[model samples]
Target: MRDSSSSSSKPVLTIGLCFLVALLEGLDLQATGIAAPHMAKAFALTPAMLGWVFSAGLLGLLPGAFIGGWLADRLGRKNILIVAVLLFGGFSLGTALADSYATLLVARLMTGLGLGAALPILIALASEAAPEQLRSTAVSITYCGVPLGGAIASIIGMAPLGEDWRVVFYVGGIAPIVIALVLVVWLKESQAFRAQTGEKIAGQGMLAQLFGPGHASRTLLLWVACFFTLTVLYMLLNWLPSLLIGQGFSRPQAGMVQILFNLGGAAGSFLTGRMMDKGHARRAVFIAYIGMLAALAGLGLSTSFAFMLVAGFVAGYCAIGGQLVLYALAPTLYSTQVRATGVGASVAIGRLGSMAGPLAAGQILAAGTGVGGLLLAASPGLVVAAVAARALLARRNRQPQ
Candidate 1:
């Protein structure tokens, strides 16, 4: 395995490639959501049917994260990531070709598998390459690619991409294939990871090591935090556009609001990531969650288009932004040997919440709950996550530094 530690060249290249990977993840994952309304029309889907379309993909992510991260620990980050990129990209292209709801469901599940596998490896590689002092900032900077991709998806949806929606997947599918080729040539295994040897890592399963003695409490809290934060974040990602359309915004206007939300998310990730590097990881994230809670409450009360856009931006800033910080922070909880596993497990657990978000929202919507009511319902999750972040910070503070 080649190590990037000796020169900035490898680390920089690794982060850059991983960033592109994150962008692809966002684009492909959000595709179904972005295409949902049109897809519903084409397939004559009920609200419940559409919700399952949103969920099948997320549910697939669970196993992918667990299995992919486990493999990365033994096989190497570069190896698993390449496979993942190819897997999702190809499946996404297949999704573009689907004619029926069942076909679309299966294709999204396959795409989700590939999508899920790549993420933990990407986080692990970025963390491994970043210096200890700047890890949070570096990973968050890299993580910004996610929202950037989401914004791009919103752009495509708003554009005359046509009601077919297949064109969106075509574009998303192609980008990752190109990126996977680039990774093969430029991305290498982490230096710290390289020194450790697979023999040592193979001695214990990544999942077992993740929950092993000293890591238990933090792991549980991290899982809890991830569950609630991602619940709100993904609920928005998968359903916000539809929610807005229901509120009477034009399709383009809804698309634009989603764009603003993701762009705000990118900005939030950039700023708070740096804050985490400056000894405010806990407070910064806690504050971000608090911001999200307030924004969600405001959203529940507001009916104006302008106010909704502003609230969407603020909510994305806190929820999606703080989620990226969680990605950066997860690896810190474990040793190099299990870092990928830790990140992967957090993501896998988080996907449970992600999987439920759209379905839960769908039920509410179907039951005659307005978008405001749904937003209000979502607020408690953010509040719980906010409390958890404060607890996590206090716990870490009392123990050592």
Candidate 2:
């Protein structure tokens, strides 16, 4: 009876813990946008400088994802995740305490590293914990925490905190430190990782494993899809509120839109995962990309608050939903031996796009481009992402399950 209960509860526990960490990550990611107006005033930053502020953390994520994922394969996922949580949590506090622009950038960079490292492991842990048939749903469930966390940050931003932007970072930093402690006490190492033989553990070089015969094409396609998909998604995430504010909306009103966006993202993430698990992977992919295109157009064209609200929700639904689909699909592309590494590398490459999105948006906006033009400009990339994603899925379908 004890054995039966333990077996039944293990997956739930793992998924639940991962969900908490993902929630913290989401909060930290969104906190920047939520605090941007105040941060700019506090630090006397320009739009281009603000863009660099956003990208600084993302830059950290690139290396963090690569190195963290690589090490998690050798070290246990639980161990690496704990350290990542602490690293991000601590620096998030640093972000709150930063007195100068340079200090703020360093804090965000370090925080991004932690956030980047934690994500691939979370995906891997959730994927490994669930039954094969339910892997997508499990990952989606874990990922839902992200937008939900973002929603929480939006709520905080809306509060009358006297424009104390540091409040967001303080909350973002402290919670993860607490969660890391809980994880240490309760989180278990991934069962799949423990089951590998010594020979497999000592297997091929990283380059060979990722780029070897059957993997090269899939890896490149995944990178392409991830890069473009994240480019659009992160742009929306880091800039949507600012864009809305730029168009003469009040900060509170923009915060409300941000909240709705995140709530919509949570719903989209959950539903897409369910659809993928029910053998509707193709349909899910189609809806994700097509919906994203329409949402971008809607966001670009909308003038009224009501229309903007609708557009925000749809953008969250499609953009974030599509990202969840990618996260769910990535783990299935490689063997367990290199699963974290593969997922991390894909995430790292995607971070490059994520980094580019904000910086490009900042520069474009600085160059006097309107929100409409900037958003419309992102359309071509989505088309490219859709094509690559479809091709990757088709290739995966042809392989043996």
Candidate 3:
């Protein structure tokens, strides 16, 4: 009974709401990273222990992705999204209050569970709400919250905010509470989803579909893409400031460069997501990955600060934009029956990279591989991602487009 035009426009409003939610989600995702140094000092943590605090959330994410996807399929995306917001918001507050490292780590991991579920549900709902013609744009805009949140956290957390790094967590946690309330009131359930999976045919759900024959390979491929992308991306974000400082920049200069790195990601998300709508999600991703490689190489090889900034900008742009646009591609490749599962699997797999990237980078640093060598080591993932992207695109294009 809904008018077609109205239906199309409604999705935009939903996208906007979800976009804000996505922003909060992104902030929560990186909130720990931004506050890590201060938190470490407060807890008297060792470097290795501090590293665990940073990655603790990711541990929660692995199960979170699977459960979130499954829950979305069973209970509906709206229900799970609302719950995720509440979950993340509460954890953010809890994280802020923790006086001990153990408590803080638990809070982060709990927050990660909310984040894991939140992402796939948001991407799925946004993509499903949009008319097929506008699908990529919708997904990308929602996803844009990732970098936008990252940038905001990086910028805001830099403030002195008195002694406690916990203030960052408090702020990060509370923002989502307001957003979740808004979503509960304003956001609409995805009609496309209702139509696609209406009244449940008895047999289909998350598990059955993921393990089904037609879906397993595509699901695995997306996972590989996420794993490598996250591994490299997190390593870059976590280490870039030190790397820059070691390259002869002052502390403030290194910090400024890190901000630029995140800003570039925001720009790339906007560009790559919109471009994906024009068709060739794979090809666009391929180009982004190639750019990521080139950017990292330039950043590593160049001596000038100006050049390093440009390289960092490009690397941040392509690395994040290319990697995340693949999430948008998820809904397209699978029917609603398997959408959440497929997306969840991909994200859950990628969480492995999130855990591994920093750990691996730390090892390389310990072994005395300089920043240049580290950057160089990370370049191959992009290359592999580029090839994977092309194959995925060619496969997708061959379908009845």
Candidate 1 Cα outliers beyond 4 Å, as residue runs? 1-6, 202-208
lDDT of each: 0.85, 0.91, 0.77
> Which of the predicted structures, 2 or 3, would earn the higher TM-score when compared with the native?
2
For residues 30-75, write the lDDT of model 2, one tens digit per residue: 8998888888888899999999999999999999998888888888
Candidate order by decreasing lDDT: 2, 1, 3
Question: Candidates sorted by TM-score, descending order?
Answer: 2, 1, 3
Candidate 3 C-alpha error for residue 286, in Å: 3.1
- Per-candidate TM-score against the hidden true structure: 0.95, 0.98, 0.91
Best by TM-score: 2
Q: How much lDDT does candidate 2 score? A: 0.91
- The per-prediction tally of clashing pairs is 0, 0, 0
Model 1 vs. true fold: TM: 0.95
